[model samples]
Target: MNEYDIKDTIAALATAYSKSALAVIRMSGSKALQIASKICFYANNENKNIENFEHRKSYYALIKDENNIPIDELIVLSTLAPNTFTSEDTIEFISHGSIIVIDSLMKLIIKNGARSANKGEFTYRAYINGRIGISEAEAIHDLIDSSNKLMAEASIYKMRGRLTREIDKLRENIKNSLMIVYGELDFPEDDTESFSYNKLIEIFIQIKNDIENILSNSKRVESLINGIKVAILGKVNAGKSSIFNMILENERAIVSNIAGTTRDFLSESIYIENIPFYFMDTAGFHKKADNDIELEGIERAKKCAYESDIILAVFDNSCNANDDDINLIEFLNTLNNKNIIYIINKNDEDKKFNYKIESGNIISISTKTKEGRETLMQALKNHTSDSDIYIFNKESYVNNREKSFLEMGLKQIDICIEKSISSFSLDEIAEEMNILNNIIGNVSGKIDAEEVINEIFANFCIGK
Candidate 1:
């Protein structure tokens, strides 16, 4: 069968980089092997015939130079039509990773009629060929250039079609509730109900809990997607800035003897083992002169800590914990679920230690000499993380926009469940429950959420 107009094959350099020890040039189309076989230089005795070897197998071959002599030893792997990655036929040439060699080979293949594959085209083909679904294809896009292991696992989990299943389940449950509402209207004189009101309420309660559980972790998911933002905060000279620089492993922030040297927020994105973090060094939290320009910096720092995913509450280990530290601890406690890790800095030297605070996972660290820094990180990880797998391989981060809608739907469901159990008409409750379909429809793009959809999928690769 023919490929596209002027039909042939689709090829791409699959090794990821232009230069490596060897580059695998991948081709998939109706006539991939036919196009490749024309130019391939067979080196081994088994290479006499490209076909009849196997449908999905490799053959030793030599890719010839312009003069038709072998310039490179290549292992040509092919899958026959209808059963390959592209489901048409596929060819992969394991050639030298040298840029010149791969480029020359690709050019030669194109000259023989195969067009260059666009970015993500092969994976797209995998999706088209039923190898994966839309969600899995989306995950494949995240997998290729995932910066952190946690992100990779999340993508992998989503690509495995878990999210699609959940979506289907939720949508189906909503449909069942909607059906019950119509069933009541469809047959009022049946003397019996096809769906029980109590059962409907119970099912919806389960659904509400499911959504609530997903939304409960949505913030943490955002933190993982865009690495946890940690703020190192304390009064000036408490070594908060010093500890920020230490966690980052560089001169990220200036260290000075001056008490108010840092009056602005300085941040760095650092990887903690497999997890990523954006650590901020904030200005001292203290009253400043009315005319002090430095007070603006302190104001920003307060906002920074308030917005932070985690806070490192540092106190001067050289001095006893004072009212400033105690007050700050109390304020951080107000964030409810915020991860605020308390650290007594300068503990490397003898200083008063006040063990009065009830902060979880408190520790001592000396940034000047780098003492207990690793333990500090582990402690911070323990403090901030709700899961040991910070990458959240099992999580599909519902975006903030989606979270809002889901929360709204969940709230409606919560009310509906209450009304259902209280003997208030389920027809009214179903109306409330179906209201969520519009909200979820907006999320799933059952409605025209093209702008949102593009913004999301565009972050994915082209083929994905």
Candidate 2:
């Protein structure tokens, strides 16, 4: 995992191994073409197609075993050298999606020259060959693992070099200022302009402002990548499970009339207007548990509310508000800065509960008739406004490690700014700029390439 040996040919099943119409077995390295040349023959003749091998072209060939008996007919594609995914001689065999065929082909490949690829070895080769940067490599992983449209879109933006362009711009501006500072230090008596403490502080302020913007907008970026966690809490038999089922338009949670039917929380991911929303249905909260199991459920519900970004306080409309409902109301009032939506379930029934909650968001919905579904969706959409969705100038951002690098760079800049106001020399300012530059380099995988590349590709699937 620490190092990748691109010199040895690596092969793996690129496509899924399940039953399908086609599967792809990929190999990349110096001996890829040689191995393919040995095992592959023309479909109509016994002549090997290796002599006529062309890069970026596909040829229908028959793969034969050691006994010269044809094993399978497949399409072999080749991409040579300095213009491939791994920047090496790469060959891919597109064959029928059969486990026996794939296993046979891989065994033949290893027998010929290639070794079985490790997890993300192909992508690691791509990274070392300069085909992609660290952010784009991580973005590729995100793109593959994205669960919703918003997450995919954000990954696309990052993979297309939007973030790299911005980071490069920041580094360019910093380098420009460093050049000026160095010029002043190397030739103080020449025609070069010597900057005062206040003047240098002015320039550093802009860089600090840029870093601060990225740091402050991290939450919005995170919401797009990993959707918001929403918890549903109410008293026993308050139709919390009913509401949970209604929102997903499927019978994901079991709904029953008996109180204390659900003793654990259930979570589901649903998209509302392209925004991913993770909804959790927790066990009902009550004054005192009848048993230890119910008590454990109540404790879990409290934990869910503590970790959620939004809370849906469901209420029953068929009966009057009891002591448990009032206690639930009092508990919700203690949560500050949490988006609480008071949902009155069973709106079709005769309303006997006249409850007043401090929360502004309130809606009445009947789970049986599916009423107020659109209204609730719109309310959720309205909660995530345009500014809340995209707080920064860009649409995507780096991962947690890169965010840490940005924060470290911010701290270094802050130090430079504070020192600029004092009797600090140009040499000291330049030294701080060097440290800031190294931080940015770390963010882009220029420095500490092994750790960054390992972290990025370690999670990727094989043959990526």
Question: Model 2: per-residue lDDT, tens digit, 1-464?
Answer: 43577778999999998888899999999998889989999898866555556889998899998878777898999999989988989999999998889989999999998899988888778878898777888888889998777778888888877777778878988898898888788777884455567777887888888777766676677765587788999999999999899889999998888888889999998888777788899998989889899989988998989888888899999999998899888898788888888899899999978877654799999999989888887877776878876553365676888889998998999999887888687788899988998897777657565565666677999889
TM-score of 2: 0.90
Per-candidate total of colliding backbone pairs:
4, 0
Tens-digit per-residue lDDT, 1-464, candidate 1: 02222244678777665578887888887767677767775577424534443687877887775566565787888778677656678788888788888878888888888887665566656654667654565567777867877777776777676665666678788887787677776786673555677887778887887787676665566577678888888987898878987888888788999878887899888777656888889988774434466778777877888778788988887877766676677667677667777888897788886647764768878887898898987876764545735435455766455567778878878777778778787567767777876666544334354354345444544322
What's the residue-level lDDT of 347 in candidate 2?
90
Q: RMSD, each candidate, Å?
A: 5.1, 2.8
TM-score of each: 0.76, 0.90
For model 1, name the residue pairs that clash.
Answer: 22-97, 41-62, 136-159, 150-391
